[model samples]
Target: MNLIEKAASRINQGDALSADTAALRSQASPADEPPHAPLVQRAQARAAEVPVHAEAPSAESEQEIAERHVSRQITIDLERLRAAGMITPDDDKHQLAEEFRLVKRPLITNAVEATSSDRNRNLIMVTSSLPGEGKSFCSLNLAISIAMERDRRVMLVDADVARPSLLGYLGLQAERGLMDLLLDPNLQMSDVLLRTNIDKLSILPAGRGHKHATEFLASESMSNLLDEMANRYPDRIIIFDSPPLLVTSEARELAAHVGQVVMVVESGRTSQDAVKEALRQLEGCDIVNLLMNKGSSTPLDGYGYGYGYGYGYGYGRSGRS
Candidate 1:
């Protein structure tokens, strides 16, 4: 019998001998057999005795890894976003997480819970009042958050033609993206859709910048793309990360197609007027909700805004009293 067949037979019989014992019994010298021969025989025997199947990683584990790897680049803690509010028992995150059991989870949990039920899958508009407000970060995080849900599909469109960030965030370099789709209207949406290592999330980057970005975004072709996506992936949440609302009318113009605007306001930096003006510009659209980004850091004593966790500073009332 061949060595492999002998090993299999020995394994099936459950009478296999150890490598040393087998070597001593065999006429061939120790130098003759390959070093791993015994190991190979044992492995074959074990496989014959017990069959096994490989499974993919769990969703929770995947999310943990994604957060760990992605959050490393930024100083922001996912927990802080949840536990930064008030401990006065009125904080939204605390109340919601307590009720839903999602508080202990990542901040994305809160975002997913907030957007999960809508039938429309919410074509949400993401924009900041001014540049450097972390709008891109907010957009990407929100998309990742929504995509974490197993039941939901997420498509992120880089509507910020001026300065796209999704491709950079994902570490992919491709010559074609949203611009290619726009330039060639006949191209399939799936052609430009790039799958991410993160599950349930696909990205359509700004293919190429145009001199008239605003006009292209507002064109019927863009509107058709949105419609096709909505129809094709009804369960998918579509997020468009666009330019600052006040800086350019691009986000506002795109809002008409999306139907809802989620304004991301940077705390301590964006002026009240700019925010108000941006809100006014999006007055006609359906606003999913408003989020205060980078609102305030945790106070010195660890009591500050209730991030997703709980208001660290204002935990139990007895401690405060």
Candidate 2:
């Protein structure tokens, strides 16, 4: 019998395949009597257990997906997450809001918790080992988080010269940014810094793309710019959204100036070796912490035939509390 038939027979006999198990075994063989039918049935059976209200398999507009993502953010709660060990009790989102006041409040809590400390490491840079690892998302949230800190000024700089993303993420105008400041060393800091809607938070966007972007960041002007910002705003936190280490040398150069580097690793996508190599490549700054996104599909998985998080099932927020 084919794998699906084998699986069905096994299930009927009260020995079902694990839901979390890999699906590669179910791929149909060339000699199968009905090529894709059995595999489809197996996929259906597996999908039935999850109860997801997914979109039909069809092309979707990018705007629709972006809207859906933004809507999902409203449901994430601090107390619920803390119970799941996703965040600490004291570091819960609500508790953090009380301590810090800033616009786009959720981003701030995500940053503070991921970094795990408020003292010492405030000039933050959020980056990844490679592209599409959620570095921009991490950087934006961190800047928002530091701004939320009561009576603190925060500046979010879009320093990803190669490919700037913060403007698009925030849906902001791409007119002027850090590139302008670098090109015109005489430009006053106030001219380049754009204050966001968030109280006490400012942004220095990637002003304009230039051929010598890497050399610009590596220059003495870069050091002077950072030093000027540091001295000008003593209590404010500066967050630099830099390019991924493996993708470019921007992260290494920026890390040298920042107080701490918070590396973002997409839970399922980021390889352990890539993470180790990224750390090795940029060897000096304090690695503030590692933020594992989409953290652990099943935290209790991998142990052979053992009970899961809550009595062989997942835990609710109430259970977590």
Candidate 3:
């Protein structure tokens, strides 16, 4: 029997395979008779388990699929990425890349923990105390780094309604996305997602910025969209490049829908007071991870190695009451 035949046999016998269990038995010889008929029977049996009235898949349009992917995908320059200290799987182990790997661990853990009632744990928002604090840099890099993982897909959303920069950063043109979905009831998510050549990374540009952006962010439609994105795929990490917390109401409003928040603090540039106030704006978030960017580097100290970056993560302790 073939691989499918063994699977069919297992299913027919009412034997469920465990996560670690091998899919097929080696004893099944290639010369064995075709088990196609048995496999169909097994599949039919499994289909019987689903509710007969369960809703069918949404009939998403071809336009939706087409618009999601552009005629040409923007090829990220490897040398530019390396010089900018961004993560690329092909490059040698970089210090910045290593630091981000450590940076993403806790967030990934929170995303996977089923016990947590919050569905937005995987929906992470990256913002800053103010502009030029490296939040965009951090957001892009974080998404790329996470996408490098074999098991995870990254959906990087440009949520900076006030200043949408991801398209420029990625060397792409303006495209419809998050805001468009909210404004137009006819638009589906697949209608605006920009499919990149990057193995597992996709971009969702912040559509035409709305005048009442904050109101749109906190709308019921926005909530539904977020839920759909969160549950559509279990292995996705949705990263939002949000506007500066202190500058835009949309950022503060966006925080309400996210399970985790990453506040970027420019080490030498951002003031302590600004950082405190920026964090204060995200008062309702249960988990806020403070990422200190542009910090001074030190030589190996008592710990045998000096850590260049700083991060603070917690539940409601990050100015989130």
TM-score against truth, every candidate: 0.58, 0.57, 0.73
Worst lDDT run of 10 residues, candidate 1, spans 312-321
Look at candidate 2 and tell me the lDDT of residue 44.
Answer: 52
Q: What C-alpha lDDT, on a 0 to 100 scale, does residue 29 get in candidate 2?
A: 8
Against the reference, the lDDT scores of all candidates come to 0.51, 0.53, 0.67
Cα lDDT tens digits for candidate 2, 1-321: 632233223323422111111111121000001223444555556546754677554332232222222211211233433442321224535422222222223333333443333322445677778887666755655565665556566778898977888776654567576888889856655555665545556677788999988888889988777766654444566788888899888778888776556666654566656766776665565433354433322344676433212111111111110
By lDDT, who's the top model here?
3
Q: Which whole-number lDDT from 0 to 100 does residue 74 have in model 3?
A: 53
Q: Is candidate 1 or candidate 2 better by TM-score?
A: 1
Evaluate model 1: give its lDDT. 0.51
Q: Per-residue CA lDDT of candidate 3, range 181-288, in tens?
A: 889887666667777767678888899978988899999988888877777667788999999878778888888998888876654456656766776677677777
Clashes of each: 16, 6, 0
* Native-structure RMSD, model 2: 22.1
Model 1: per-residue Cα lDDT at residue 181: 77
Over 164-199, each residue of candidate 1 has an lDDT whose tens digit, in order, gives 876664445644567777778566554555655556
